[model samples]
Target: MKPLCLSLLIPAVLFAGATVYNAPAGVEQDKLFQVKVAGQPSFVYSLPVGGMTYFSYTSFARRADIEITVARPVETVAIRPTSYGIRPVINGNVITFRLDRTAQISVEINGDIKHPLLLFANPPESAPPKPGPSGIHYFGAGQVHNVGRITVTSGQLVYIAGGAIVRGSIFMDQARGVHILGRGVLDGSLYKKGESRMIEVNRSSDVDIEGIIVTNSKHWTVPITASDKVTLHNVKLVSDNDWDDGVDVVGSTNVTVDQCFIRTKDDCVAVKAGVQYFTKFNAQRDVSNVVIKRSVLWNGAWGNGLEIGFETRAASIRGVRFLDNDLIHVEGPEGTFSIHNGDRAVISDVIYDNCRVEDSKGLLVDFKILKSRYSKDAERGQIRNIVFRRIRVDQAEMPSILQGFDATHQVGGVVFEDVKTGGRKWTSLADAGIKATHTENVSFK
Candidate 1:
């Protein structure tokens, strides 16, 4: 097979914070392609062909109308995984597409899987909200702000501009009323393993994080621990390393995570009552009232698409909700929706509603209250009152598993309503290919 070859050409624009890249010199100039979004030129980079059998990369634009002009004429062009239902208007080699909202999608040329374009449509940039009477730390666009480790104080605002790249990590410890807002990029590529998370909020209250793209994180992309009333909105995280979870909420209450896009190598989103980092702070308190909704999650490796607890240590975790989300790809043994309650926390009142899972290489759903090697506690947790409603899966290879450790700590009061697989309504547990072991009060509708 011939080596896949493609070139990109980005026009120079006057946008202050737009990303820019220089094409390599060896490729034919005629093979170059240009992409324009919302009248502004965006920086496009080739995604590395990793262990996967394809080539892709990350690109960003703030505009809804995207125009791509490829150098060579194409016989056929289509978007892969077809579940996204994106159709581009092909005029010769020039393609025009419109996006109503921001998304991460792949573009294939001539039915070729060897080389494809992974495009990330970012939301339009707005002026960073004023810091108000409180202090404001701002980083404008078209610049690289090297902040090794930033710690925000109470009642402060840290704003990153749309084109600016903040190379470092952000920390909020023991703070209240902190706001982190931007359309910019927080890049953790420079951070080594175990250094720090791309963003860490600990012991904070009434915090808000919005409209930021985080890339190449060495550790967890975002970890909010021991924080209450925290809200994350319209944030996008892309990671290619191990343990690079998109967003991890641990030992927190009243947390709302919405309108985000996460493509990572680990769990896209994980909710835990307590972990090693916040065990002391979450000793007696429970994690409750957390909602993750209207987000897109893609797991690269070694994790669940949406998971709750393997290291849970708190007394209880309640009122957790995952709603109106799209799990595009889950590439691990762990299922698309997983609840592995390993510790002593009583996990209850959890709901997964209106979720659309496109592809899961493993199981569709796995819920178990059992002890694992990763658990610090010897006793398993109790999982009850869990509901999966209007959940749809396009493809799943393995059967779902719902098991409890024993009768004492069994999974109970579980219901799957209006669940569908491959356009077939799953009215029974067997139809859903779910294996229930040592569980009680399981119902399907």
Candidate 2:
């Protein structure tokens, strides 16, 4: 995909407009198209090659009208998560649409997935916190701060204001009651891959991270290991490098991720037990009570959309829920709802409720308990008591796999209720593009 000329950004830099918020002043803009929101200019961020441009705004649930003029001739336009049923009107190289509520959608022009535009419409933030509080670290708007690493302790707060860009990674190790709240950007573009994770929480408790954009992570975007009672809301993750998973909850409990947008080359969100972190931190605990709901995910070529593991060395991984998440795009060799248990954990009580898949070039569902290269245990694991309810797939072209290691280590007690693929309700494994092997008690309702 050819990048548009950068000269179009010269006029955009001087515009006085009704922006949703102040953007970082020095970042490069995507000039493939000119965007206007409510008759004012809105900036679209240009990422590296093979990545897409993204524009985000806050609307407070009010109707927002957006206009985009393409730099080239337009033939067709499509908006997704098709579940939203948004149809735009295009006139001469220009596109227009209205959104009544908050959504994260992809605007694909001329059916070009390679150069699509990701539009993130956000809800209004209620009472954004300010500076000068005790134990509070605040970075102001529109400035680029070159802080490399932020080591947060217990009972601390790090607030990144909108338009502020912090070139750093945050680590909360062996801490409690830490809050990382912001609308600003946490950029890891300066670091090489494997150098840092954008935000890492190890052996922490009672943590709240919300409304921040973590982009270009050197490694995993956010990895919560051996943590408890963590909440991540309205977060946006954008990274396309290898191993740049959006969020990984390894051996964590009582974690809730709500209303976020994640686009990555690796898994959008993954759950694991006893998985080794990059450092020698806490890696000994069960994975339970992890909930990911009301989020938007775009998985690139390397990993699953919502995965359980290829690393489960703990005793069990239980009570994980995926509710009302829209997987907008998944391009992979992995499945959309996958549980790849390679270790000795007895993974159970997992459910996917009201999940929708818009476009997937891979399998729709995959549950396998087999050893892979990521396995660390001598004994294989099992997957049981899993449910998929009200899952609707719009476009999926691959067959799902349900396989177990052997007779003793199996995948059992699985049920799919009210599941639909390609606009057809399925009651059989073949109808849902599923193939089972060495499994037990799998049924559709």
Candidate 3:
């Protein structure tokens, strides 16, 4: 697939320190679109249309009315998957829309569904401060601050103000009471893959990251490892490289990810019990009490929409919840709700409630306790007490799967209540087209 060739006609809109980006020369354009939020300009990139089964760069907006201007005469404009309930009012080439919360929307012009624009609208932040030393490391607006590999210590607050593009990554290790707050862009374009993450919280606690836009990460965008009481709110992460996950919570507890927009080339959000990279600190920890609510997850080349444990080295992982979220687009062989517990951990007490899956090229649900290539232990894990309540799939190509490793490690206590596919209620395992093997106490209500 090739990128669309277009041009930006408008100059940069500068208002109160916010600057919208103009597409540079020699860069190809797609539809020549421009996005503005609260009279401030945002940078839009021209990405390949549906290249590697994922959409292009996603633009962001605050809670105000958003205006999108495409450089073409539109015959018709519509937002897809229909579940977002966004009614865009079109006047010529400009389309106007507003969102009450965060959303991942595909804007189609003239019925060109393959080259649709990806837009994400986020809620505004309350009580944003000026660039001053209130115990905050503030980056002022309209300037490209090049700080490489910022190491945040304990009781530090890093604030990147609006319109400021900070070109670096943040590393927080063994820190406490850390806060990363702002409406700025943290670009990891200068770093190499596996060199750094956009925001890495390792062995930290009581950390808060809110109202930021992270782009062009070389590795996993935001990886929280061995952390507790971590809260990520109103954050937007967009990446176009391999292994660029939206957020990977590994061996963490009491974590909450709310109202965020994540578009990555890998898993949108993955909960794992110690992978190979962070084996030292995470090998003995379990992931528990995690909640991801009211967010948008879009996968690019590979991986699941919301996944758990392909590298299970801990003892147990439980009490995970995915509530009131949207799985907009998932490609490849993974499912919208997937659990590949390949290690010796006992995984249970997980729930997927009120999730609306728009279009998945893989399975709707996939739960398996098998030994994969990433597994270290010969003994497989047990999976039980899992529930999927009120999950609606608009389009799916494959059926669900629930399989155990062997007779010793079985899957039990799985239930699906009021699950729907293509607007039809699923009353039984056969009605939902699920393949169950070596499982017991599986019910559909």
Candidate 4:
């Protein structure tokens, strides 16, 4: 399916005798456009917005058209590298406009396509940035006595030194190449209602959040969404609020979460494809290639170490590895480390290696086959190629519950090698290790 593109329409105030202009030479041939004002070709699609004109592009299927709202004057609007071939024909067409690397092209509207106009056929800018300290300059909604929230755009680098205490969620929504470094402390204990997050990095790339302490957030504490090449290293998340989750990664890829310490009331680290309520477009959401290694989880009496999928479908989580992590006092139902595939998705190729656990009262590992038995979106499939190596658990009150729904939608190819448990004799390894049923290819070596 073609991604959705917004065709910005010029407001009705700037319709002077506007001029028509065409693109310059050397523009990409694949991307094309046609600009109109009052239903006239007042400006070429390749021309920059010198004034108020409506802009339309392929939304989906190369034929569907969409328009958005824009505000820019003609004189200040300049379209560099102005020419290209005719626009493609498709429906719900969503073209990616990356900065820097993408050749310069301009769109003519009666107005500008806003500040961050989408560049058709251009790749995101990958300019070789100068070397400097890599971190986030946080402007969250908090108080030094009320030093308001900080907003940093994508591709900007700000270093946070150690021992700096700030109150609020650092907004990294539109930022790229963000780095949170040093022994910094982002205190989010007093977050207000309707705030986005303690540290939210969304739609960005090459981000690194490391060696920081995020404490006392009121909501999802540190969430990275729709981003890529992110690293969370040696970070400590202390959530005192009821809804404070440590890390919620949604629609992201190539993330490495290592050597972190978490004590929260919710799941310490949840690898999610996307949430159902907020995300509607399947093309805009996906998460993959994540690794959580050598971390410690604690204090959540009902929290999960690693959980996947909540509500929405269209998820395909692959190449995820959780290795050398330590879990302490991770409390939840028997099926806490739950892999839930709702519909139109498959959660596969996940591995957990050399993970040490402590004080797990509920089931050690549980994989849910269908979202629910009766839901219609339930495309029954197997949880394939899950491997757990050298997982040592200590002190569980009940039996570990690991099961699949049926033979067809069973937990496929679960390899549990060198798995040992220590507990009281009544609920020991022989009795409480695994209570699996309706599974296939489950072997312990």
Q: How much does candidate 3 score in TM-score?
A: 0.86
**Candidate 4 on 1-445: residue-level lDDT in tens?**
0112323232212222221122222222122343343333422222121121122221211221223233322333323222222232222322222222212133333333322222222111122133344433542211122234556676665433332345555776656766665433466645664354777777778887765556567678777777788898767676545667788877788989876767667778887654532333332365678898877665365556677654325447778888977665555553446676555456789988888775565667767666564234546545778887777766544455556767666777877767666623332224546677676677767
Q: Please give the CA lDDT of all the candidate structures.
A: 0.74, 0.82, 0.77, 0.54
Return the clash pairs for model 2, or none.
none
- TM-score ranking from best to worst? 2, 3, 1, 4
Q: Candidate 1 vs candidate 4: which has greater TM-score? A: 1
* Candidate 2: 10-residue stretch with minimal lDDT: 9-18
Summarize candidate 1's per-residue lDDT along 1-445 as a digit string, tens digits.
Answer: 0122444333223343233322222222222356766545444443331111101112343335667777668778776335567788999898888665466565667865334555655554454465344478887654567788888999988897655667788888899999888766687867887677888888889998987778778888888888899999888787778888888888889999998878888899999865755235543358999999988787876898999988788889999999998887787878788999989999999999999887688878889887787688776789999999998887633489999988798989999899888878877777778898889998988
Q: Write the per-residue lDDT of candidate 2 for residues 1-445, one digit (tens) a residue.
A: 1223333222212222223544555667766867777676666777652223323344343566889888879999988877787889999999999877777777888878777777766555567777788888898876678899999999999998766778899998889999898767788988887888889999999999988878887698999999999999988898889899999999989999998989899999999878776858658589889999999999999899999998898999999999999998899878899999988999999999999998887878888988899888999988999999999887644588999889998889999899887777778877777789999998999
Candidate 4 segments exceeding 4 Å error: 1-145, 276-284, 334-336, 372-381, 396-398, 423-432
Clashes of 3: 1
TM-scores of the candidates in the order shown: 0.84, 0.92, 0.86, 0.62
Predict model 1's lDDT versus the native. 0.74
Q: Note the clash tally of each candidate.
A: 4, 0, 1, 53
Between candidates 2 and 4, which one is better according to lDDT?
Answer: 2
Candidate 1's C-alpha runs over 4 A off are: 1-33, 38-40, 46-63, 70-84, 91-93, 102-134, 278-284, 396-398
Q: Kindly list the per-residue Cα lDDT of model 3 for residues 226-325, writing each as its tens digit.
A: 8899999978887778788889988899999998878787899989876758336644488899999988777777888999978877889999999998
What is residue 221's positional error in candidate 1, in angstroms? 1.2
lDDT of 3 at 378: 72
